[model samples]
Target: MTLTKDYKVLSCDLDDTLLREDMTISKYDSRILRELQKLGVNVVLSSGRRAYDIENRFKQIGLEKDGAFIIGSCGCEIVKVDKMEPICTKVLSNDTINVVVDYAQKNNLNLGRNLFHYSIFISQFKEFYYSTTHLVYTCQNPYNLEHLRITNIQPLKVDYEAIRKMCLESPPTKLFITEDPIAVSSKILPEISKVLPLSSRALITKAYFCEVIPTDGGKGPALQWLCRNYIHCEMDEVVSIGDSANDVDMLEMSGLSFAPSNSFDVAKKAAKEVLNWSNMESAVGRMVNRVFFNGTFLMTDEEKADSKIE
Candidate 1:
Protein backbone atom coordinates (compact mmCIF):
# COMPACT_ATOMS: atom_id res chain seq x y z
CA MET A 1 0.00 0.00 0.00
CA THR A 2 1.23 3.48 -0.84
CA LEU A 3 1.36 6.20 1.79
CA THR A 4 -1.60 8.52 1.59
CA LYS A 5 0.63 11.57 1.89
CA ASP A 6 3.99 12.27 0.26
CA TYR A 7 6.67 13.00 2.85
CA LYS A 8 9.22 15.73 2.16
CA VAL A 9 11.37 15.52 5.25
CA LEU A 10 12.76 12.65 7.33
CA SER A 11 13.75 13.97 10.77
CA CYS A 12 15.53 11.12 12.58
CA ASP A 13 16.92 10.53 16.05
CA LEU A 14 20.58 9.49 16.21
CA ASP A 15 21.76 7.11 18.93
CA ASP A 16 19.31 4.19 19.10
CA THR A 17 17.18 4.81 16.05
CA LEU A 18 19.31 5.44 12.98
CA LEU A 19 22.60 4.11 14.32
CA ARG A 20 22.77 0.47 15.36
CA GLU A 21 23.86 -0.76 18.80
CA ASP A 22 27.49 -0.77 17.53
CA MET A 23 27.21 2.98 16.74
CA THR A 24 27.38 2.45 13.00
CA ILE A 25 24.78 3.04 10.28
CA SER A 26 24.14 -0.07 8.22
CA LYS A 27 24.99 0.04 4.49
CA TYR A 28 21.33 -0.53 3.71
CA ASP A 29 20.31 2.46 5.82
CA SER A 30 22.99 4.68 4.29
CA ARG A 31 21.85 3.83 0.77
CA ILE A 32 18.25 4.68 1.63
CA LEU A 33 19.34 8.02 3.14
CA ARG A 34 21.34 8.87 0.02
CA GLU A 35 18.46 7.85 -2.18
CA LEU A 36 16.09 10.12 -0.22
CA GLN A 37 18.40 13.12 -0.66
CA LYS A 38 18.73 12.43 -4.38
CA LEU A 39 14.95 12.54 -4.67
CA GLY A 40 14.95 16.10 -3.20
CA VAL A 41 13.83 15.01 0.26
CA ASN A 42 15.46 16.93 3.09
CA VAL A 43 17.11 14.70 5.72
CA VAL A 44 17.55 16.39 9.11
CA LEU A 45 19.48 14.82 11.97
CA SER A 46 17.64 15.80 15.13
CA SER A 47 19.45 14.78 18.29
CA GLY A 48 20.53 15.81 21.79
CA ARG A 49 24.18 15.54 20.62
CA ARG A 50 26.36 18.50 19.77
CA ALA A 51 26.11 19.54 16.11
CA TYR A 52 29.85 19.22 15.57
CA ASP A 53 29.81 15.58 16.62
CA ILE A 54 26.76 14.80 14.48
CA GLU A 55 28.45 16.21 11.37
CA ASN A 56 31.62 14.25 12.10
CA ARG A 57 29.69 11.03 12.70
CA PHE A 58 27.70 11.39 9.45
CA LYS A 59 30.92 12.08 7.56
CA GLN A 60 32.21 8.62 8.54
CA ILE A 61 29.13 7.08 6.88
CA GLY A 62 29.52 9.35 3.82
CA LEU A 63 26.17 11.14 4.46
CA GLU A 64 27.40 14.67 5.20
CA LYS A 65 26.74 16.96 2.25
CA ASP A 66 24.93 20.10 1.10
CA GLY A 67 21.19 20.54 1.80
CA ALA A 68 21.59 18.64 5.06
CA PHE A 69 20.56 20.31 8.35
CA ILE A 70 21.21 19.45 12.01
CA ILE A 71 19.04 20.10 15.05
CA GLY A 72 21.66 19.76 17.77
CA SER A 73 22.03 20.38 21.51
CA CYS A 74 18.57 18.94 21.82
CA GLY A 75 17.06 21.66 19.63
CA CYS A 76 18.96 24.64 20.98
CA GLU A 77 20.49 25.21 17.54
CA ILE A 78 19.89 24.48 13.87
CA VAL A 79 22.84 24.30 11.47
CA LYS A 80 22.93 24.35 7.70
CA VAL A 81 25.60 21.75 6.92
CA ASP A 82 27.43 23.34 4.00
CA LYS A 83 27.69 26.67 5.83
CA MET A 84 28.81 25.09 9.10
CA GLU A 85 26.97 27.88 10.94
CA PRO A 86 23.72 27.93 12.81
CA ILE A 87 20.98 29.79 11.04
CA CYS A 88 19.18 29.86 14.38
CA THR A 89 20.26 29.25 18.00
CA LYS A 90 19.20 29.63 21.64
CA VAL A 91 21.40 29.39 24.75
CA LEU A 92 20.96 29.30 28.51
CA SER A 93 21.48 32.53 30.43
CA ASN A 94 24.38 32.92 32.85
CA ASP A 95 22.05 33.31 35.80
CA THR A 96 20.20 30.10 34.87
CA ILE A 97 23.38 28.04 34.51
CA ASN A 98 24.76 29.42 37.78
CA VAL A 99 21.65 28.25 39.63
CA VAL A 100 21.95 24.73 38.18
CA VAL A 101 25.67 24.62 38.99
CA ASP A 102 25.00 25.41 42.62
CA TYR A 103 22.34 22.69 42.79
CA ALA A 104 24.73 20.16 41.22
CA GLN A 105 27.46 20.90 43.75
CA LYS A 106 25.02 20.55 46.63
CA ASN A 107 23.71 17.23 45.27
CA ASN A 108 27.23 15.83 44.59
CA LEU A 109 26.44 15.17 40.95
CA ASN A 110 29.02 15.48 38.16
CA LEU A 111 28.30 18.43 35.88
CA GLY A 112 29.68 17.92 32.38
CA ARG A 113 31.62 20.93 31.05
CA ASN A 114 32.24 22.07 27.49
CA LEU A 115 33.96 25.03 25.86
CA PHE A 116 31.62 27.22 23.82
CA HIS A 117 34.17 27.69 21.08
CA TYR A 118 36.99 25.75 19.41
CA SER A 119 39.86 27.69 17.89
CA ILE A 120 42.98 26.13 16.36
CA PHE A 121 45.11 29.21 17.11
CA ILE A 122 44.18 29.04 20.80
CA SER A 123 44.87 25.28 20.80
CA GLN A 124 41.52 24.26 22.24
CA PHE A 125 38.76 21.78 21.36
CA LYS A 126 35.22 21.11 22.54
CA GLU A 127 34.53 17.82 24.35
CA PHE A 128 31.33 15.91 25.16
CA TYR A 129 32.75 12.92 27.07
CA TYR A 130 29.67 12.64 29.29
CA SER A 131 30.89 9.56 31.15
CA THR A 132 33.82 11.26 32.91
CA THR A 133 33.01 12.17 36.50
CA HIS A 134 35.97 14.51 36.93
CA LEU A 135 36.17 18.01 35.57
CA VAL A 136 38.92 17.83 32.89
CA TYR A 137 39.70 19.06 29.40
CA THR A 138 41.58 16.92 26.88
CA CYS A 139 43.23 19.69 24.90
CA GLN A 140 44.41 18.62 21.48
CA ASN A 141 45.56 21.32 19.10
CA PRO A 142 44.45 20.76 15.54
CA TYR A 143 47.58 22.52 14.28
CA ASN A 144 49.78 20.17 16.38
CA LEU A 145 50.99 22.60 19.04
CA GLU A 146 53.67 20.93 21.15
CA HIS A 147 53.41 23.27 24.16
CA LEU A 148 49.64 22.71 24.56
CA ARG A 149 50.18 18.94 25.02
CA ILE A 150 52.04 19.44 28.32
CA THR A 151 49.11 21.19 29.99
CA ASN A 152 46.45 18.67 28.89
CA ILE A 153 48.66 15.56 29.29
CA GLN A 154 47.66 15.43 32.93
CA PRO A 155 44.16 16.28 34.21
CA LEU A 156 44.30 19.81 35.50
CA LYS A 157 42.29 21.17 38.44
CA VAL A 158 39.47 22.45 36.20
CA ASP A 159 37.11 22.93 39.06
CA TYR A 160 33.63 24.45 39.43
CA GLU A 161 35.21 27.88 39.42
CA ALA A 162 36.42 27.27 35.87
CA ILE A 163 32.92 26.35 34.74
CA ARG A 164 31.52 29.54 36.29
CA LYS A 165 34.13 31.67 34.53
CA MET A 166 33.40 29.96 31.21
CA CYS A 167 29.67 30.53 31.64
CA LEU A 168 30.20 34.21 32.33
CA GLU A 169 32.31 34.53 29.20
CA SER A 170 29.84 32.64 26.97
CA PRO A 171 26.67 30.81 27.88
CA PRO A 172 26.51 27.07 27.18
CA THR A 173 24.06 25.45 24.78
CA LYS A 174 22.83 23.11 27.55
CA LEU A 175 23.82 21.84 31.00
CA PHE A 176 24.20 18.12 31.71
CA ILE A 177 24.00 16.49 35.16
CA THR A 178 25.18 12.90 35.52
CA GLU A 179 24.40 10.76 38.56
CA ASP A 180 22.84 7.47 39.60
CA PRO A 181 19.64 6.91 37.64
CA ILE A 182 17.60 6.49 40.78
CA ALA A 183 18.95 9.66 42.38
CA VAL A 184 18.60 11.58 39.13
CA SER A 185 14.95 10.62 38.80
CA SER A 186 13.95 10.72 42.47
CA LYS A 187 15.70 13.59 44.27
CA ILE A 188 17.91 15.56 41.88
CA LEU A 189 15.51 16.47 39.06
CA PRO A 190 12.40 17.26 41.13
CA GLU A 191 14.31 19.40 43.63
CA ILE A 192 16.29 21.25 40.97
CA SER A 193 13.07 22.05 39.09
CA LYS A 194 11.89 24.21 41.97
CA VAL A 195 15.11 26.28 41.91
CA LEU A 196 15.44 26.82 38.15
CA PRO A 197 13.49 29.59 36.42
CA LEU A 198 10.21 28.81 34.73
CA SER A 199 11.80 29.51 31.36
CA SER A 200 14.22 26.61 31.85
CA ARG A 201 13.25 23.07 30.82
CA ALA A 202 14.81 19.76 31.84
CA LEU A 203 14.42 16.15 30.66
CA ILE A 204 16.09 12.80 31.21
CA THR A 205 17.96 12.13 27.97
CA LYS A 206 19.64 8.96 29.24
CA ALA A 207 19.49 6.68 32.25
CA TYR A 208 21.98 8.77 34.23
CA PHE A 209 21.98 12.05 32.30
CA CYS A 210 19.53 14.95 32.78
CA GLU A 211 19.81 17.74 30.23
CA VAL A 212 18.62 21.33 30.81
CA ILE A 213 17.95 23.76 27.99
CA PRO A 214 15.67 26.71 27.18
CA THR A 215 11.94 26.14 27.53
CA ASP A 216 11.53 26.35 23.76
CA GLY A 217 14.38 23.98 23.00
CA GLY A 218 13.66 20.33 22.04
CA LYS A 219 13.56 18.08 18.97
CA GLY A 220 9.83 18.71 18.50
CA PRO A 221 10.02 22.50 18.61
CA ALA A 222 13.10 22.53 16.40
CA LEU A 223 11.35 20.42 13.76
CA GLN A 224 8.34 22.73 13.82
CA TRP A 225 10.59 25.74 13.21
CA LEU A 226 12.42 23.98 10.37
CA CYS A 227 9.18 22.94 8.71
CA ARG A 228 7.78 26.47 8.74
CA ASN A 229 10.99 28.28 7.70
CA TYR A 230 13.53 26.00 6.09
CA ILE A 231 11.73 23.14 4.43
CA HIS A 232 8.47 25.05 3.78
CA CYS A 233 6.40 21.92 4.43
CA GLU A 234 3.49 21.20 6.71
CA MET A 235 3.93 18.99 9.76
CA ASP A 236 1.80 16.34 8.05
CA GLU A 237 4.38 15.91 5.29
CA VAL A 238 7.13 14.65 7.64
CA VAL A 239 8.06 11.14 8.82
CA SER A 240 10.12 10.55 11.96
CA ILE A 241 11.75 7.67 13.89
CA GLY A 242 13.08 7.78 17.43
CA ASP A 243 13.15 5.81 20.73
CA SER A 244 13.50 7.77 23.99
CA ALA A 245 12.01 10.50 26.16
CA ASN A 246 13.81 13.14 24.11
CA ASP A 247 12.14 11.77 20.96
CA VAL A 248 8.55 11.99 22.23
CA ASP A 249 7.92 15.52 20.99
CA MET A 250 9.20 14.89 17.46
CA LEU A 251 7.25 11.65 17.22
CA GLU A 252 4.01 13.34 18.10
CA MET A 253 4.66 16.20 15.69
CA SER A 254 5.38 14.10 12.59
CA GLY A 255 2.85 13.10 9.91
CA LEU A 256 3.93 9.48 10.40
CA SER A 257 6.06 8.21 13.28
CA PHE A 258 7.82 4.94 14.08
CA ALA A 259 9.37 3.39 17.17
CA PRO A 260 11.66 0.36 17.20
CA SER A 261 10.75 -2.86 18.98
CA ASN A 262 13.06 -2.05 21.89
CA SER A 263 11.78 1.52 22.42
CA PHE A 264 10.42 2.69 25.71
CA ASP A 265 6.68 2.28 26.26
CA VAL A 266 6.22 6.05 26.31
CA ALA A 267 7.90 6.31 22.92
CA LYS A 268 5.86 3.48 21.44
CA LYS A 269 2.64 5.10 22.61
CA ALA A 270 3.62 8.36 20.94
CA ALA A 271 4.51 6.76 17.60
CA LYS A 272 1.96 6.04 14.88
CA GLU A 273 3.37 2.53 14.51
CA VAL A 274 6.01 0.30 16.13
CA LEU A 275 8.24 -1.73 13.85
CA ASN A 276 8.83 -5.42 14.45
CA TRP A 277 12.55 -5.07 13.65
CA SER A 278 14.93 -3.43 16.10
CA ASN A 279 17.57 -0.85 15.21
CA MET A 280 20.26 -3.53 14.70
CA GLU A 281 18.17 -5.09 11.92
CA SER A 282 17.98 -1.87 9.88
CA ALA A 283 14.52 -0.76 11.02
CA VAL A 284 14.93 2.62 9.41
CA GLY A 285 15.88 1.07 6.06
CA ARG A 286 12.93 -1.28 6.09
CA MET A 287 10.51 1.48 7.03
CA VAL A 288 11.85 3.67 4.24
CA ASN A 289 11.22 0.97 1.65
CA ARG A 290 7.68 0.43 2.88
CA VAL A 291 6.86 4.14 3.01
CA PHE A 292 8.65 5.56 -0.04
CA PHE A 293 9.27 2.56 -2.28
CA ASN A 294 5.95 0.79 -1.65
CA GLY A 295 7.76 -2.27 -0.28
CA THR A 296 9.33 -2.90 -3.68
CA PHE A 297 12.83 -3.78 -2.40
CA LEU A 298 14.78 -5.02 0.67
CA MET A 299 11.99 -7.17 2.11
CA THR A 300 13.10 -10.03 4.34
CA ASP A 301 11.16 -13.16 5.27
CA GLU A 302 10.54 -11.88 8.77
CA GLU A 303 9.41 -8.46 7.50
CA LYS A 304 7.07 -10.03 4.93
CA ALA A 305 5.58 -12.17 7.63
CA ASP A 306 5.13 -9.20 9.94
CA SER A 307 4.08 -6.68 7.27
CA LYS A 308 0.80 -4.87 7.84
CA ILE A 309 0.16 -1.57 6.05
CA GLU A 310 -1.46 1.26 7.94
Candidate 2:
Protein backbone atom coordinates (compact mmCIF):
# COMPACT_ATOMS: atom_id res chain seq x y z
CA MET A 1 0.00 0.00 0.00
CA THR A 2 1.22 3.50 -0.78
CA LEU A 3 1.55 5.55 2.43
CA THR A 4 0.95 9.28 2.28
CA LYS A 5 2.31 12.10 4.43
CA ASP A 6 -0.87 11.71 6.50
CA TYR A 7 0.98 8.74 7.93
CA LYS A 8 3.99 10.71 9.03
CA VAL A 9 4.77 8.49 12.02
CA LEU A 10 5.88 4.89 12.39
CA SER A 11 5.26 3.03 15.64
CA CYS A 12 6.34 -0.56 16.22
CA ASP A 13 6.72 -3.33 18.77
CA LEU A 14 10.25 -4.55 19.51
CA ASP A 15 10.58 -8.28 20.06
CA ASP A 16 9.48 -10.44 17.16
CA THR A 17 8.67 -7.30 15.23
CA LEU A 18 11.49 -4.79 14.79
CA LEU A 19 14.15 -7.08 16.28
CA ARG A 20 15.07 -10.52 15.05
CA GLU A 21 15.36 -13.56 17.32
CA ASP A 22 18.88 -12.56 18.32
CA MET A 23 17.46 -9.31 19.74
CA THR A 24 19.27 -7.36 17.07
CA ILE A 25 18.10 -5.07 14.27
CA SER A 26 19.04 -5.92 10.73
CA LYS A 27 21.26 -3.38 8.98
CA TYR A 28 18.64 -2.90 6.30
CA ASP A 29 15.91 -2.18 8.84
CA SER A 30 18.12 0.38 10.59
CA ARG A 31 18.92 2.14 7.34
CA ILE A 32 15.26 2.35 6.36
CA LEU A 33 14.24 3.94 9.68
CA ARG A 34 16.99 6.55 9.27
CA GLU A 35 15.81 7.17 5.74
CA LEU A 36 12.25 7.64 7.01
CA GLN A 37 13.54 10.28 9.40
CA LYS A 38 15.09 12.03 6.45
CA LEU A 39 11.61 12.16 4.93
CA GLY A 40 10.42 13.87 8.16
CA VAL A 41 8.62 10.75 9.34
CA ASN A 42 8.81 10.15 13.08
CA VAL A 43 9.80 6.66 14.17
CA VAL A 44 8.65 5.65 17.62
CA LEU A 45 9.64 2.52 19.46
CA SER A 46 6.75 1.16 21.48
CA SER A 47 7.49 -1.76 23.74
CA GLY A 48 7.08 -3.43 27.09
CA ARG A 49 10.87 -3.31 27.31
CA ARG A 50 12.51 -1.03 29.81
CA ALA A 51 13.76 2.36 28.68
CA TYR A 52 17.40 1.36 29.07
CA ASP A 53 16.91 -1.86 27.16
CA ILE A 54 15.22 -0.07 24.28
CA GLU A 55 17.84 2.69 24.30
CA ASN A 56 20.71 0.15 24.27
CA ARG A 57 19.26 -1.64 21.26
CA PHE A 58 18.75 1.62 19.37
CA LYS A 59 22.38 2.48 20.06
CA GLN A 60 23.40 -0.76 18.43
CA ILE A 61 21.35 0.28 15.38
CA GLY A 62 23.42 3.46 15.19
CA LEU A 63 20.24 5.56 15.53
CA GLU A 64 20.52 6.43 19.20
CA LYS A 65 21.34 10.05 18.36
CA ASP A 66 18.53 10.45 15.88
CA GLY A 67 16.00 11.71 18.42
CA ALA A 68 13.57 8.80 18.17
CA PHE A 69 10.79 8.51 20.75
CA ILE A 70 10.27 5.56 23.09
CA ILE A 71 7.24 4.25 24.93
CA GLY A 72 8.57 1.89 27.55
CA SER A 73 7.26 -0.19 30.45
CA CYS A 74 4.18 -0.34 28.30
CA GLY A 75 2.56 3.09 28.15
CA CYS A 76 3.33 3.79 31.77
CA GLU A 77 6.33 5.83 30.72
CA ILE A 78 7.31 7.90 27.70
CA VAL A 79 10.77 9.24 26.98
CA LYS A 80 12.16 11.46 24.29
CA VAL A 81 14.98 10.25 22.11
CA ASP A 82 18.34 10.38 23.90
CA LYS A 83 16.88 12.36 26.82
CA MET A 84 16.70 10.99 30.35
CA GLU A 85 13.67 13.06 31.21
CA PRO A 86 10.33 11.33 30.88
CA ILE A 87 7.32 13.06 29.41
CA CYS A 88 4.88 10.83 31.28
CA THR A 89 4.85 8.32 34.14
CA LYS A 90 2.30 6.00 35.79
CA VAL A 91 2.95 3.88 38.86
CA LEU A 92 0.97 1.47 40.98
CA SER A 93 0.68 2.01 44.73
CA ASN A 94 2.91 0.38 47.40
CA ASP A 95 0.03 -1.16 49.31
CA THR A 96 -1.17 -2.93 46.20
CA ILE A 97 2.31 -4.26 45.55
CA ASN A 98 2.48 -5.53 49.13
CA VAL A 99 -0.76 -7.34 48.61
CA VAL A 100 0.48 -9.00 45.42
CA VAL A 101 3.77 -9.99 47.04
CA ASP A 102 1.97 -11.42 50.01
CA TYR A 103 -0.43 -13.37 47.84
CA ALA A 104 2.38 -14.80 45.75
CA GLN A 105 4.30 -15.86 48.85
CA LYS A 106 1.24 -17.43 50.43
CA ASN A 107 0.50 -19.31 47.23
CA ASN A 108 4.09 -20.50 46.79
CA LEU A 109 4.32 -18.57 43.53
CA ASN A 110 7.32 -16.50 42.48
CA LEU A 111 6.98 -12.75 42.81
CA GLY A 112 8.82 -10.26 40.63
CA ARG A 113 9.04 -6.57 41.35
CA ASN A 114 9.22 -4.17 38.43
CA LEU A 115 10.58 -0.87 39.80
CA PHE A 116 9.27 0.93 36.72
CA HIS A 117 12.59 2.71 36.67
CA TYR A 118 15.88 0.95 37.38
CA SER A 119 15.69 -2.73 38.33
CA ILE A 120 13.32 -5.67 38.48
CA PHE A 121 13.22 -7.24 41.96
CA ILE A 122 12.54 -10.97 41.99
CA SER A 123 11.99 -13.44 44.78
CA GLN A 124 15.05 -15.31 45.95
CA PHE A 125 13.50 -18.66 45.06
CA LYS A 126 12.47 -17.31 41.68
CA GLU A 127 13.77 -20.37 39.87
CA PHE A 128 11.60 -22.86 41.70
CA TYR A 129 8.60 -20.59 41.62
CA TYR A 130 8.96 -19.20 38.13
CA SER A 131 10.16 -21.11 35.09
CA THR A 132 12.33 -18.39 33.55
CA THR A 133 13.17 -16.20 36.51
CA HIS A 134 16.79 -17.10 35.88
CA LEU A 135 16.74 -15.20 32.58
CA VAL A 136 16.03 -11.87 34.25
CA TYR A 137 17.95 -12.20 37.49
CA THR A 138 20.66 -14.29 39.18
CA CYS A 139 18.81 -14.89 42.45
CA GLN A 140 16.37 -17.76 42.59
CA ASN A 141 12.84 -17.66 43.98
CA PRO A 142 12.83 -17.36 47.72
CA TYR A 143 12.63 -20.76 49.36
CA ASN A 144 11.90 -19.46 52.81
CA LEU A 145 8.76 -17.50 53.46
CA GLU A 146 10.57 -15.92 56.42
CA HIS A 147 12.69 -13.77 54.10
CA LEU A 148 9.61 -12.22 52.47
CA ARG A 149 10.07 -8.84 53.94
CA ILE A 150 8.96 -5.85 51.86
CA THR A 151 11.17 -2.81 52.31
CA ASN A 152 12.87 -0.14 50.20
CA ILE A 153 11.35 -1.64 47.06
CA GLN A 154 9.88 1.11 44.98
CA PRO A 155 6.37 1.29 46.37
CA LEU A 156 3.77 0.55 43.68
CA LYS A 157 0.36 -1.00 43.85
CA VAL A 158 -2.67 -1.70 41.67
CA ASP A 159 -5.95 -2.76 43.13
CA TYR A 160 -5.85 -6.42 42.22
CA GLU A 161 -9.60 -6.70 42.59
CA ALA A 162 -10.11 -3.52 40.67
CA ILE A 163 -7.57 -4.48 38.04
CA ARG A 164 -9.22 -7.85 37.79
CA LYS A 165 -12.55 -6.17 37.40
CA MET A 166 -11.17 -3.84 34.77
CA CYS A 167 -9.50 -6.67 32.91
CA LEU A 168 -12.74 -8.58 32.79
CA GLU A 169 -14.63 -5.52 31.65
CA SER A 170 -11.97 -4.64 29.09
CA PRO A 171 -8.88 -6.21 27.61
CA PRO A 172 -5.65 -5.28 29.33
CA THR A 173 -2.89 -3.63 27.30
CA LYS A 174 -0.79 -6.68 28.13
CA LEU A 175 -1.42 -9.40 30.71
CA PHE A 176 1.50 -11.32 32.22
CA ILE A 177 0.84 -13.97 34.84
CA THR A 178 3.51 -16.68 34.67
CA GLU A 179 6.79 -17.60 33.06
CA ASP A 180 5.07 -19.87 30.57
CA PRO A 181 3.45 -16.85 29.00
CA ILE A 182 1.24 -18.56 26.49
CA ALA A 183 -0.23 -20.96 29.00
CA VAL A 184 -0.97 -18.30 31.57
CA SER A 185 -2.30 -15.83 29.07
CA SER A 186 -4.59 -18.32 27.44
CA LYS A 187 -5.76 -20.12 30.57
CA ILE A 188 -5.46 -17.50 33.23
CA LEU A 189 -6.62 -14.54 31.19
CA PRO A 190 -10.18 -15.72 30.88
CA GLU A 191 -10.20 -16.75 34.51
CA ILE A 192 -8.90 -13.36 35.58
CA SER A 193 -11.46 -11.74 33.37
CA LYS A 194 -14.05 -13.51 35.47
CA VAL A 195 -13.11 -11.02 38.18
CA LEU A 196 -11.76 -8.03 36.21
CA PRO A 197 -13.05 -6.18 33.22
CA LEU A 198 -10.64 -5.92 30.28
CA SER A 199 -10.46 -3.19 27.73
CA SER A 200 -12.18 -4.15 24.52
CA ARG A 201 -9.17 -2.88 22.59
CA ALA A 202 -6.53 -4.76 24.59
CA LEU A 203 -4.23 -7.13 22.71
CA ILE A 204 -2.35 -9.93 24.45
CA THR A 205 1.23 -10.77 23.49
CA LYS A 206 2.62 -13.97 24.93
CA ALA A 207 6.34 -14.55 25.42
CA TYR A 208 8.40 -16.28 28.10
CA PHE A 209 6.83 -13.65 30.34
CA CYS A 210 3.50 -11.75 30.55
CA GLU A 211 2.65 -8.23 31.71
CA VAL A 212 -0.65 -6.35 32.28
CA ILE A 213 -1.07 -2.82 31.11
CA PRO A 214 -3.69 -0.63 29.40
CA THR A 215 -5.33 -2.08 26.32
CA ASP A 216 -4.08 1.03 24.58
CA GLY A 217 -0.65 0.45 26.06
CA GLY A 218 0.60 -1.35 22.99
CA LYS A 219 2.48 0.56 20.28
CA GLY A 220 -0.72 2.39 19.34
CA PRO A 221 -0.94 4.57 22.41
CA ALA A 222 2.75 5.18 22.59
CA LEU A 223 2.81 6.30 19.02
CA GLN A 224 -0.23 8.48 19.55
CA TRP A 225 1.45 10.09 22.51
CA LEU A 226 4.57 10.78 20.50
CA CYS A 227 2.69 12.19 17.56
CA ARG A 228 0.66 14.51 19.73
CA ASN A 229 3.43 15.57 22.08
CA TYR A 230 6.55 15.38 19.97
CA ILE A 231 5.87 15.03 16.28
CA HIS A 232 2.57 16.90 15.91
CA CYS A 233 1.39 14.28 13.47
CA GLU A 234 -1.85 12.40 12.89
CA MET A 235 -2.63 8.71 13.20
CA ASP A 236 -3.51 8.25 9.54
CA GLU A 237 -0.05 9.39 8.52
CA VAL A 238 1.90 6.48 10.03
CA VAL A 239 2.79 2.93 9.14
CA SER A 240 3.31 0.15 11.68
CA ILE A 241 4.69 -3.37 11.49
CA GLY A 242 5.05 -6.36 13.80
CA ASP A 243 4.74 -10.13 14.12
CA SER A 244 2.86 -10.89 17.32
CA ALA A 245 -0.28 -10.19 19.33
CA ASN A 246 1.23 -7.22 21.21
CA ASP A 247 1.59 -5.60 17.81
CA VAL A 248 -2.10 -5.91 16.98
CA ASP A 249 -3.21 -2.60 18.45
CA MET A 250 -0.66 -0.51 16.60
CA LEU A 251 -1.20 -2.46 13.43
CA GLU A 252 -4.90 -1.76 13.48
CA MET A 253 -4.44 1.90 14.33
CA SER A 254 -1.83 2.72 11.73
CA GLY A 255 -2.65 4.08 8.28
CA LEU A 256 -0.91 0.97 7.04
CA SER A 257 0.16 -2.12 8.97
CA PHE A 258 2.45 -4.78 7.54
CA ALA A 259 3.20 -8.22 8.87
CA PRO A 260 5.72 -10.77 7.67
CA SER A 261 4.57 -14.09 6.29
CA ASN A 262 6.05 -15.70 9.41
CA SER A 263 4.03 -13.58 11.86
CA PHE A 264 1.49 -15.25 14.09
CA ASP A 265 -1.83 -15.95 12.45
CA VAL A 266 -3.62 -13.44 14.68
CA ALA A 267 -1.13 -10.70 13.82
CA LYS A 268 -1.34 -11.41 10.12
CA LYS A 269 -5.10 -11.26 10.30
CA ALA A 270 -4.96 -7.88 11.97
CA ALA A 271 -2.48 -6.36 9.55
CA LYS A 272 -3.69 -4.32 6.61
CA GLU A 273 -1.12 -6.06 4.45
CA VAL A 274 1.36 -8.90 4.77
CA LEU A 275 4.95 -8.67 3.63
CA ASN A 276 6.38 -11.33 1.36
CA TRP A 277 9.32 -12.02 3.72
CA SER A 278 9.68 -13.03 7.33
CA ASN A 279 11.85 -11.47 10.03
CA MET A 280 14.67 -13.84 9.11
CA GLU A 281 14.32 -12.38 5.64
CA SER A 282 14.45 -8.82 6.90
CA ALA A 283 10.80 -8.16 6.07
CA VAL A 284 10.66 -5.03 8.24
CA GLY A 285 13.48 -3.49 6.22
CA ARG A 286 11.73 -4.30 3.00
CA MET A 287 8.51 -2.65 4.11
CA VAL A 288 10.24 0.45 5.43
CA ASN A 289 12.19 0.93 2.24
CA ARG A 290 9.10 0.46 0.15
CA VAL A 291 6.99 2.87 2.19
CA PHE A 292 9.49 5.63 2.86
CA PHE A 293 11.92 5.69 -0.04
CA ASN A 294 10.10 3.73 -2.70
CA GLY A 295 13.30 1.70 -2.66
CA THR A 296 13.56 -1.70 -4.30
CA PHE A 297 15.45 -3.76 -1.73
CA LEU A 298 13.16 -6.73 -1.20
CA MET A 299 14.39 -10.19 -2.10
CA THR A 300 13.62 -11.42 -5.59
CA ASP A 301 11.47 -14.47 -6.39
CA GLU A 302 14.59 -16.33 -7.46
CA GLU A 303 16.12 -15.75 -4.03
CA LYS A 304 13.07 -17.21 -2.29
CA ALA A 305 12.90 -20.09 -4.72
CA ASP A 306 16.59 -20.87 -4.15
CA SER A 307 16.25 -20.72 -0.38
CA LYS A 308 13.25 -23.03 -0.40
CA ILE A 309 15.17 -25.55 -2.49
CA GLU A 310 18.16 -25.36 -0.16
- Considering every candidate listed, which one attains the maximal lDDT? 1
**After best superposition, candidate 2 residue 143: deviation in angstroms?**
19
What TM-score would every model get versus the actual structure? Answer: 0.81, 0.69
Model 1: worst 10 consecutive residues (lDDT sum)? 143-152
In candidate 1, which residue pairs get closer than 3 Å at backbone N, Cα or C atoms, i.e. clash?
none
Task: Please identify model 2 stretches exceeding 4 Å from their true place.
Answer: 1-6, 64-66, 93-108, 116-175, 197-203, 297-310
lDDT of 1 by residue, 1-310 (tens): 3332379998888877887665677777776677776777788888887777677656765665677888988888888776555777888987788898788767556665445444322225332221212223222222112212311222333456677677667787787776777877898778888888877877876666677888878888899999899889998999999988788889999999999887878789999999997787778888888888777656555544433212
Q: State, as a TM-score between 0 and 1, how close model 1 is to the true structure.
A: 0.81
Please, what are the lDDT tens digits per residue for candidate 2 over residues 1-310? 2333446777766777777665666666776676666666667777766555677666776664446777776665677655444676554333333343344344434333332323333466221110111111112333212112211123233434444443344322233344445544665445434433343222345443435454335566767777777787777877888777667767887788988887888789989998888776667767776776567544455544422322
Q: Pick the TM-score winner.
A: 1
